[model samples]
Target: MIDPLQIDDILASGGALSKYFSSYEERGDQIEMSKLVLQGYEENMAEVIEAGTGIGKSFGYLVPAILHYEETREKTVVATSTITLQKQLVDKDLPTLMKALGKDIPFALLMGRSNYLCLRRYLDNTVSQSIFASDPTSEDGKLATWVRTTEDGILDELQALPRGVLKSDIASDFELCLGQKCPNFSRCFFFKSRKKAESAGIIVTNHHLLFLDAKKRCDNDEDYTEKALLPPYNRLIIDECHNMDKNATSLFTQVFSYYGFLWEYRKLVAVKHGANASNLITLAAGIVKGKENEALDVIKELESAEKIINNLNSILVMSLSGSEQRVDKSNYSFFLSKYSASLIAIKQSLDKITSLLNSIIGKTAFSDEDSYIQQGINSAICTFEGYSSFISEFLNIKEFKDKVYYLTREKNKNREEVQLKISPLEVSDILRESIFEKLDSVICLSATLKVDREFDFFRNQVGLDQREILSGCFESPFDYKKNLLLLIDNGKVLYKNNQESLYFDHAAEKIISAVRASGGGALVLFTSYKMLEYVSSKALSELAGFNILIQNGELSRSQLLKRFRDDKDSVLFATQSFWEGVDIPGDSLRLLILTKLPYPQVNEPLFKSRCEKLESEGESSFMMLSVPSMIMKLKQGLGRLIRSKDDKGVAYILDGRMNRSREYFLSQLPPCNCPDDFLDESLERRIEDFLY
Candidate 1:
């Protein structure tokens, strides 16, 4: 298929990249990675590669991808972990690639089904704004204009929904959409994007949507080849592959949030004062007059549902008396026995509500206009059915050799809540069967996919350990040793997870001093909110002269990042989410801090379940799961610094256990400077000296 491996002519000294840029430093690793990708496509198997920063791994895969598409005319779905990367590919990289290629390639970006505006739902909810926003000064007027003119009705284009509208009222939803039976079938934004994507050879999507395609194919095997979620694709490229397992676990995890479960009924029947505050079932009853008896029946069911939900949640909150617990089949049987009466009552209520709605739908099926109402009612039926089904499945856990059952608590202003959940102990086998094996070829590449210079941890975690696959590790071309310096606490912050008072004071003082010396451009990462809050309290008072932002503050992540990035002298203290995907490539981010090593919380139910499984298999769960996992995350934190060749930064690890795991740390990361001694008061001065 067009000689997929013949790439030297395009990537050599006078090749496409060199001619495209006036001062391009060709990276050999990039070419090598491109070859590895091409080999994967040629051989029709999985290829796992760990390419370091500055390797331009995107282009490495893109060049081969374009060649393969040209030869085979087979679609390739590229899945990324973050929306930031998806935007980068579609908005930035693709244009540059197009310019370099001297032509356009057929490509499209598709998000999950719920991201686009459901024209049917939007119109059904807001009639005027959905059609003619003639009052040009109004928000609805603007939205109407957007609705008429926008190519893809993605929520990303709009800043906010109307003041009274819920996202579900306007955006695409799984529970909604009657497919071709709807009046707006041809014009539906999600299906329009899907249809548009069918023409493109390359499609870009995020990990959730990618796995959703897999799950849909698995759950709907009779229609497996029908392009259920994504178009049929022969080859797949997964960037940010290190996050695959985490994302897969989240995708597979089933949860019934107690509050959310209660809110479904509230949305249906709760009436409150204010414009448009009357719930949907109330408004629907008014719209379709003459269904008074059925509407009354719906009301009675909702009242019963609310009481049962409160009792169910009360049972969980009172019985557990802890934040989390791992449950066995016996526990499931216990819960089933405890909640069986309440569960059956709620089911009866939900079933009654569903039946009434279905009856209304049956009577309102005259015209396409009338049918939108029926469709919305149908959607409500699905939601109620889904809620009932999930509760049933959660308590009805049976024969769970591959899954973990658990319960969790969330504290709020009014209620102590619990969430019942079931997560896969390991997503490796699930992913191997559901996604990788189904595809003709797969390329999983990331900057931090390996542990101790080997893909053993990642491969085994993703169920590719025994698969016939090609793997490689490509080091970054940048002079990390020259550009980035790593400083350890030497013994000042004696954090052995004990002597808590001593560790907090010393670590906080060190963090404050470093940020002060840097004059505010620092990202101090912590493993827990408790520590983040403790240090932020100390810093906010001590470092009052500088702009300081803390994680879980009043601002959103994007807002905090904007302030941190735009103001060159702002320090942002954040937790796990900020460790990666932070690309501040300038002098503003010359200092990074990690207060503690990131080890999985041993008490968390999912982590405990996985560790127990590993232990049962006669493996050292801490050595195999904990250490490698910590190292990968450590590498991610370090990679946040020196994102580009021009950027120079210093990172500090303030935990004493870091020295204990020195061997694993040294073997896992790239070559960087780590001066042995910093046990004294000169650490702050050293950071300033290095930066200035």
Candidate 2:
């Protein structure tokens, strides 16, 4: 084995860690972890490190992983939790590290097929166009118009457009996709992304795609299978490891929607006289009818709706032309009005179907008494709820309504096969064995994994055996007492027992007060939408003239973040998505307000199952499962602050649970002292002092 790289010598070189990175605390942690990871790789063990806020852990692991691979002539794969972070590694961190290290390291960004543009979509809408040339003025015409302006059909780029635009315009399943068999294969974006990954030495991918690749392997072991995404690599590093469990779970479960069915019906209705109209409707109706033991009339209504949608799609395709400038105005308006109406009709039908499905659930005892049946019904209910939302969005006067198309697939393996629409629930096992187990060395790093410094929660959730697990914690460089303050406010009135709304009001009051005191620079974090909406309204009203932005509102997360960073007097209140992968240097944000203890509700269906399994061992469900999960999330939230040495902030938790309900959860939070006088009135002065 190679001698371990000297941490002192590496730090003295002051490579990428010195340039573009202002936090010494962050740089120091990176160097240490880099050394530890190299050593761990040499010893053939799993490394888990908890690097607190302001620790530039990304570069720390990335630089070392790249350098080690170079020195040893081995390949490495890096995994992160978010696409945003994945981009940072691919576009920013790795580039800087390579430059500083003076080595040309190969790297690639890999993502799900959906994340990339659908070349078939572009070609169908562009070259031998279907949505436009036949009906310039139709809804498909607008999609063609949007497609002309877009380089590729990447849904994310159309953020300025309405909701369904991205989902409809960009989404193309492998089954629905014509693949290389399509006339548009010459310029397929998905294949291009895959090619990029195939050429790279170090690959960056999210948890979803990582698991998706594994799922693909399970589905088909043939050439160009999903395993193609995970080329040969010797080392693996998974940042934000806490999210792996949920990511894995989400990747393993499956669900389908009626809105998709309704969209198809609307499409058929739009394409009334097209060649495939009747044939498409018949197939669509067959798929809808095969779902479950629904009432005959309900099934017939759904089939009729599907036929109508099929007709619409066919007509819309015929009316459009390839040239975007040749859009038919009158036809477009006609299709929009009729499309909206048809969608509303289908939505109403779906609502009835949803109610029927819900009523069928629990009312009639299942003769089979099998878990799969219950899972199917539960999926149906979820799909119904999701489709209801989609119908509402589609019927509204939304710009995206015209640009999107929806389709439903009948996944029938055989006549006797129980056709269950599938979506994956977990990627952990696949990630563990395929990536982690396959690696010569591995490091799973995140601030939130070990609650109370115990790796048991993260270990079991991530599916890594305890014997191979090695762990450590790196302290933050910031002065915790002087720069950071944790408010152990158990006395904050929660109005009534389990009153979520009251808790929002209480939390909002504290946040608004903090904004006032700090001259408006705070990020109030919430756990859910209802809480975010309630508190955002209150905070907005009080913090007048200050840029008080609420997440899940009018703006996207990135847009809100830009607005927050652009103005020193702005405050951003957001959810778990904003917990990590955010960088704000200087004093733009100095106060972090948490509305409650960040616990995944044990009552949520997925968590309920995990909790049941844990309870079977005579363990406290909250301590073993919920508490660790939340603590990791909370650490991620707290991490947003003190991004660099020039930054300092205060974190305030309004929930009494942190102090009262369970010590195990509380102990997992970042170790910091409470303010001598942690009151609302003195909050601003405290923050100002911390920053200055």
- List candidate 1 segments past 4 Å from native: 1-6, 123-151, 157-165, 178-187, 222-226, 266-291, 310-323, 329-348, 355-366, 396-400, 410-417, 491-501
lDDT of 1: 0.79
Q: What lDDT would each prediction earn against the true structure?
A: 0.79, 0.61
Compared with the true structure, what per-residue lDDT tens digits does model 2 show for residues 1-692? 54545444445345334553565322556567767877777777788888766566776677666666677766677788887788778778788777766779788877776766665544432222443435646555655566566544445554453323345444554534555655656767666666766767688888887666655654564322224557655577888777787777666654323345554433322222333433223323334444344444445666765665555544444443321111123244664564566566656776776665554453434333222233344544566567667557434423321122222222221211111122222344555665455545678887666666677767776667534766788766666655666765555675344776666677777777767767767888877776788888877677778877777556878789888998877888788678777888767887888777777864453455456556876988877777677777777887787776656677777777565654555466555667545665666676666555
Per-residue lDDT tens digits of candidate 1, residues 1-692? 55533576567678876899888777888888998899899889899999998999888898888888888888888999988898888878877877987757788899998788888656646544343468756777877777788888877766545556656556776654677877788888888788878988889999988887887787777233467678878799999999998998999888776567554664465453346556556556666777767777777777777778778888888888667887775576776777778777777777878888776545543454344345456666888888778767765666766888788987643468878788888888877877777777889999998876678899888877767889998998878888888887776457655677688888889898888888878999999887888888998999988898887746767778888999888899999899888888897788899988888888788888788888999999999999888888988998888888898888988887778767667767888888776654888788878888
What global local distance difference test value does model 2 have? 0.61
Q: By summed lDDT, which 10 consecutive residues of candidate 2 come out lowest? A: 411-420
Model 2 TM-score?
0.71
Candidate 1 global TM-score: 0.90
